[model samples]
Target: MLQLTDVAKSYPTPQGPLFVLDGIDLRLAPGESLALMGESGSGKSTLLHLAAGLDTPDRGEIVLGARALSSLDEAGRADLRRQRLGLVFQQFHLVPSLSVLDNLTLQARLADREDRDWTHHLIERLGLAGLEGRYPEQLSGGQQQRLAIGRALAPRPELLLADEPTGNLDEGAADQVLDLLRALIGESDCALLMVTHSARVAAPLDRCVHLHHGRLADRTP
Candidate 1:
């Protein structure tokens, strides 16, 4: 469902242009789960951003299904993201003012595709049914993260891009959230590509790839 070919990205630094990702070639099939592993400055997250279309590559191409991201303008990319991509972050980016229920349905509403039954099912499956009226600040870290996951899945996206999704939670909470994420993704048949530094977190994924010095390494753990 997702493919990247010769993808490269660079940013201007005081010294010169610093390469963050170089010639990345990867493909994710429908309903497959992949984990990206790397240390600080290894460009794992950069690859994720490029794949998600949150940021464009300086060169090369990112293709989702048959549509090439480089071929689309900003507005078109935004439209594609809303309809086809579901994103989860290390930090739960929940709207503090909105209740759990509202946050879960926000993306679906934005896309004008809100299905009350679908949203309700997501909330219940994510264990947020009784807590829907609670705000982000009032929920525990795990609850908030679950709410974020519910929000991402509410849209029934074709691809899910998660960046350090368990980074902010404690061990127990992280495990719970990751398990739920895996199960939900499986049940929905959505492709997943996640960036993580923890081996424990990446272990359950179908495949794991490591990045070093902006290039994909032929290594896995």
Candidate 2:
């Protein structure tokens, strides 16, 4: 459902342009999960951003489903992202003022695709059945992360892009979150592209790839 071809990305620096990704090619099919691994400054997050349509590649094409991302204007991209892509970040970007239920349903509401039955199912599956009335600050770290995951999936997005989604949690919490995430991904049949530095985090994915010096290579294990 997602593909990138001969992608290159660079940013300006004092000396010249600093290349982040060069000649990168990758693909993920529907209901497939791929883990992207890289050291700091290796452009893992950059690749995720490009794939999510949050940023454009300097060169090469990004195709989601049948549409070319480069063919879309900013507003078009925004609309597509809102309607089809789900994003999760390390920060657990939840709205502090919104209750857990509200936060969970926010994206679905925005997309005008809210499914009460599915949202309720997610709340139960995420171990958040009793915390719907609570706010972000009122919940534990793991609870907050689970709530974030629920929000992302509430819209039933076609593709889910996660950047170090478990980065802020402890090992136990991270493991729990990953399990829940994987289960939900499977249930929804959404394609997942997750960027993580830990081998443990990438282990459960269907395929793993490493990013180094602006390119991708298959990673076994």
Candidate 3:
């Protein structure tokens, strides 16, 4: 349940304002997964940031469910993001000091919505049943990533925004992680918007779209 309309974003440069997104429009429905594909400098991440309300667009509207992000103040946006959004980045931004269990429940705790049963279920689904006491550095890359995903999903967010979620893993690991992610998203009925450059990464999604020079084009592959 996300929508963007005539969204444009630009940043100041020495030469002039460099536009990263121009008149971009897109939508994703609840329980639907969509892959965003783009080359470097094509504004894929910018679009994600805007949708996540991490950054404000220079123009246009972003609607998440029934609320318009542009209508919210900074604090309101922050609250909305904390309560409604789940984020996964290329880098597993886990707390080094926190145990795997703590890291997994961190977001849920912060959101004041921690559920022990759901967290435990997520740990099992993510293949992280035995390493609850381990720290991020003690785990493998895939393990750490799974923990990150678990943390994001712990609160049962309405929308999940993932940027380069499998970028650091080998092909086999990537595929495994993707499968787990898809399965979990389906079970949770949370909408997914994943930003990736690989066609293979986008292949499993319900729909795929490519970004080019700040614009979006439907991509069948």
Candidate 4:
């Protein structure tokens, strides 16, 4: 459902141009799970941003469901992102003023595809019951993270991009969040691309690809 061919990104540095990714070639099938493992400064997040259309590559192309991202203008790319992509971040970027239910439904509403039943189901599945009226600040870190997951899945996106979804939680909370995410992803049958450093976190994925020095270092067993 997603493909990257000869994808490369670079930035101007004080010394010279610094390459963040070079000759990246990746393909993800529908409903597949991939874990992107790398050290700091290894460009995992940069690659994710490119895949999500939040950033454009300086070379090559990113194809999502046969649509080449480089060919789309900014507005078109933004629309594509709104319609086809779901993003989960490490910070749980929930709106501070909105209630949990509103936050969950925000993106779907924006995309003009809000489903009340699905929203309710997501609330229940994410263990967010009876907290619909509460603001994000009122919830615990784990609850907020769960809400973030719900918000991402509320639109039933074909591709879900998660960056360290469980990074901020305690071990028990992290396990709970990861289990919930995995179960929900299975239930929805969406392709999942996650960036995480922990082997325990990456172990559950279908494949793990390690990135180093702007290139694929190893495809682990």
Candidate 5:
């Protein structure tokens, strides 16, 4: 569903251009899950952003589904991201003014694809059944993360991109969230490309790759 070939990215610095990703190649098929493991400054997040259409690489091709990212202008990329991509980050990024249910359905509504049945199903599966009326501030960290996951999946996105999704929670809560996320992703059959630094975080994924010096190598079993 997502493909990156010869991808390279760099940014200007006082010294010179600092390359973050160099000749990175990756592929994630439909319904497949891959964990991207890297240390800080390994370019994992940069690659993720490029795949999500949030940024363009300096070189190389990124094809989401059949459309090459380089071919799309910013507006076109935004539209595609809105319609086909689901994003989760370390921060919940919930609307403070919106209730749990509204937060969950906001993206779907924006995409003009809101389905009540699916929203309720997400609420239940997210363990947010009785708390629909509450706001983000009222929920615990794990609850907030679950709500974020529900919001992402409410539209039934074709692929989900997550960055340190459980970073804010304790170990117990992180496990719970991961379990819920894995189960939901399975039920929806959406491909996943998650960036995490923890080996434990990458263990359950179908495959894992490590990013180092702007290159990718499969994690040795």
Candidate 6:
């Protein structure tokens, strides 16, 4: 339920304005998954930020469902993010002091939509049943990442935006995390837009698109 049309983003440099995304067009429907692939400096994160409304694009529009992000003020965007969007990143952004259960329910509680059943389901499904009282530092890397993913999903968001979600883990752990992620997304019928550089990481997604020269180039692999 996300769409980007004629999107272009640039930043000022000593030389001149450096465009990172030029006329980028992409769409992710509900229950669909997309992998955004690119080399460093290809603007994959920029595009993800635009879609998440974390940063505004210099031009073009990003629409989440029926809402146009360009029309929203910062507060509105934050509200939208809280209610409709779930975000995961390479670095697990867990609160160090909060218990695993608290972290998982934080966003949902903030949105005033915490569902205990769903939260408990997330805990069990994420393989975090016995570790509810533990803090982020107490868990292993994979466990921490799973907790992060669970936290993001606790709110039952319409869309999940992940940037290098498995980057910190070993290959085996990364694959395991990806499998769990896709399974959870499927069970919830949530759309996924994951930004990653590895083709292997992108391989399990429904579609993969490469970002080249500030544009999206569709590729089967």
Q: What is the C-alpha lDDT of each candidate?
A: 0.90, 0.94, 0.93, 0.92, 0.94, 0.94
Stretches off by above 4 angstroms in model 1 are none
Model 2 TM = 0.98
Model 4, position 120, has a per-residue lDDT of: 84
Q: lDDT tens string, model 2, 28-84?
A: 999999999998999999999998888999999999999999999999898898899
What CA RMSD would you report for each candidate?
1.1, 0.7, 0.8, 1.0, 0.8, 0.7
Q: Runs in model 3 with CA error above 4 Å?
A: none
- List of clashing residue pairs for candidate 6: none
- For model 6 the TM-score comes to 0.98
Candidate 3 residue-wise lDDT, 1-221, digit = tens? 99999999999999999999999999999999999999987999999999999899999999998999999999999889889999999999999999999999999988999999999899889888998998999999999888898899999999999999999999988888999999989888899999999998899899999999889999986
Q: Model 1, 93-188: lDDT tens per residue?
A: 999999988999999888788898888778888888788888999999999999888888888899999999989999999999999999999977
* Candidate 5 lDDT by residue in tens digits, 1-221: 99999999999999999999999999999999999998898988889999999998999999999999899999999989889999999999999999999999999998888999888889889989999999999999999999999899888999999999999999999999999999999998999999999999889999999999989999941
What does candidate 6's lDDT look like per residue over 12-67, in tens digits?
99999999999999989899999999999899999999999999998898999999
Candidate 4 local lDDT, 1-221, one digit each (tens):
89999999999999998999999989889999999999987999999999999998989989999899988999999888888889999999999999999999998988888999989889999888999999999999999999999888888889999999998999999999999999999988989999998999999989999988888754773
Model 6 misplacement above 4 A: none
Residue 131 alpha-carbon offset, candidate 5, angstroms? 0.8
Clashes of 4: 0
The residue pairs that clash in candidate 1, if any, are none
Distance (Å) between predicted and true CA of 117, model 6?
Answer: 1.0
Clashing pairs in 4: none
C-alpha-based local distance difference test score of model 3: 0.93
